[model samples]
Target: MTPDAGSALAGLTGADSVAHWTQRYGHALMDTFGAPQRVLVRGEGPYVWDADGTRYLDLLGGIAVNSLGHAHPTLTAAISAQLGTLGHISNFFASPTQIALAERLLDLAGAPEGSRVFLTNSGTEANEAAFKMARRNTGLDESGNGVRRTRVLALEGGFHGRSMGALALTSKAAYREPFEPLPGGVEFLPFGDADALRAAFADGGGATVAAVVLEPIQGEAGVRPLPPGYLALARELTAAHGALLVLDEVQTGMGRTGTWLAHQHPHLGGGIVPDVVTLAKGLGGGFPVGAVVAYGERAATLLGRGQHGTTFGGNPVASAAALATIGVIDRDGLLAHVTDLGAWWRQQVAALGHPLVAEVRGEGLLIAVELTAPVAADVAARALAAGFVVNPCTPTTLRMAPPYVLTREQAATFTDFLAALPHDLGEATP
Candidate 1:
């Protein structure tokens, strides 16, 4: 539709206008996402306008993918300039932007000497690459004995991705059972249970384990951070047992958690180093890009020539977008802002004394409000009606990952909404 036509469509009654577009969406698009929340016409900074011309404070930040926020000038300019110069090139060839981005990621991740990066178009692809690295690293142990390390340990309530290989590593039964007989050898340990983790490694000294995949903060599982010392123990066990520690930072990397990587946070990560780390989501701001950062010589060389490849990955345009995003995050000092604002915001919400609020958890801007009851869906619906956008991440959790550009005043507006919420909002009707 033309810009003028879209504007005219919005002039209609809000319901009619939204219905028209949503009807078209249902007919044209796949049902994977169920229904369009709203026909978002455009966005700027942390706000978006729907087809009805109504505006909303985008608290979800495109599901934590919009690091620099919507319509960021720097990201746009970088992508445009790179596309004007060079866009896509075969894997046999490389561009300066691609090389620079890879180097930048390695540097930001503090990867040791001999570490390497494998770029991809999304988080799922990054995880898929890490899965391959884990499999390929199953070589002979000491004493020249071949050890078939086929088993990969993952945590319960973890989410890797939807692709075949990545999905195999994911633990949710609903996401796995439908596609039965998935790639085998993935075992799920009870989340945050040190005993369960220790017991798993007790047998065979983890000789059959190829890798232990974990999310420093489990985003999909209601923004739960790993308990203290859990990560350090994993690192020690994996190191002593000759297994790789693969961390999936797809939802927590690139300054989302006030640190470039969540596992780098002193309190959260305890200064432990992982063998492999997968990143995406905010890496390219709103643009699509992902990477597998393999640390040390052993993990870096896991996937050698001809073992893994992607045509559109590491293209000049995507690389430029990511570089520009990183540059803006550094130049604008968003990391410190997220850290400071997130702490204050949580305190503000907690002090409201809202009976519905059970807990406020998460680091940096990735926050979740755990409710005393299973009314997150209702609360999110009310939030939408009140010119805000939030996610019902679970039956009892409301998640918010607003842009780093969000100001204190804007955040206060949301707190005011919470203060004015009806006490009986979630009460069931007889």
Candidate 2:
């Protein structure tokens, strides 16, 4: 083999062989989502190894949760140290790390100068908390026919979570149809078109319009981003209608999109301040943590006593992990690193001249490569064969959410490999 062509072959992680683990170990596990792709045993930096000891470059970053990258020394140390100190206290009390992380998230979000935060275990719960807060703040009880709030407005193709309230906001029909009776009364507006949003809320007397929920940039729809004025328009319309704007930054928050919040992008920010912001994914930096931050009186008086609670939500270990990850990101300048690298990386991939590639989009460490043809699955298999990990958001769309820890050299190498994807897939070879 030529020196640059590749590495060794003994026990190498060829794609077909790695699938064998799904046969051996996966049988014992329940069939939640069919079978496992690979029995990932260890991870470090931007790579993961299967049970056969084959390592592949990881570009997904655990679906954008591993911000500092896998098994990062600082993140690991902080979690371990915190676990040794004070692991869990339930939601009945406050842990210093939890309080500090909440304060840090609110401070970074720049929520009208002063904001209150509600802690939860995951993004769904965080969103659930935000929903409860909005309902509480409305001060219109569901029973009284008092003010009769009719609906919440969510954009089409936007994804928040799988919970009943959040699912009601998600636009995908497949995820919602089966689970009907889902706390209805929400209007679905086509994304990216400000006119649609305006038209939807125009009829409602604004009394029934409780809140407007949307991602600053949509991530699940293969990282589809809104045009410059859409988010700003949503903010304006929501405010005009007396409806609160809820920004779902679960996947876009933290430094994933080069800024602490993706909505901070000038085109999107547009001097808009939201009432509720829900975050998860990158918040804990691979540890399980989620939060709902409420601004003004809307967040303060909502959900009074015994309204909602989570047991393992905001454990000290996860809080420490978030604190360590945030510090390292700021100190190491990873935010700027993601911005510069993200821009350059997308440009290089766009220049690949592959027939299969239709477009590439996203911000910072979150990105997606859209293929003209519906060959994303085959391309992913091919890329895995060549020793890189990627995901197919749709049959024609592939998403890459690499760690902010990815080096420039690594991004460049992936670009080169992506350029060859069309040829490999056409050959019907893996």
| TM per prediction | 0.95, 0.91
Worst 10 residues of 2 by lDDT: 1-10
CA-RMSD of model 2: 5.9
| Candidate lDDT (C-alpha), each | 0.91, 0.80
Cα RMSD (Å) per model?
2.4, 5.9
Number of the top candidate by TM-score? 1
Q: Which residue segments of model 1 deviate by more than 4 Å?
A: 1-16, 141-144
What does candidate 2's lDDT look like per residue over 1-430, in tens digits? 2323233233446553556557654756687567777777678899988767877889988888989889989888898889889998887788889889888877887876557887777888887777765566462655754565557888888888899988888889999999998876777878788777777766656666778888887888888888888888777777776677888989988888899888887645754678888888888788888888887665655667788878887878878888898999999999999999999999989988887778988888789999877788887887887878888888888899988989889988778888766564644533
lDDT of 1 by residue, 1-430 (tens): 5446655534456555777889978988999889988888778999998877899999999989999889999999999999999989877998898899999999999999999999999999999999998888685765657877888999999999999899999999899989988888899999999999998889685888899999999988899999999999999999998899999999999999999999999868977889999999999998999999999899998898999999899988999999999999999999999999999999999999998888999999999999888888888898999999999999999999998899889999998988887887667722
Poorest 10 consecutive residues of model 1 by lDDT? 7-16
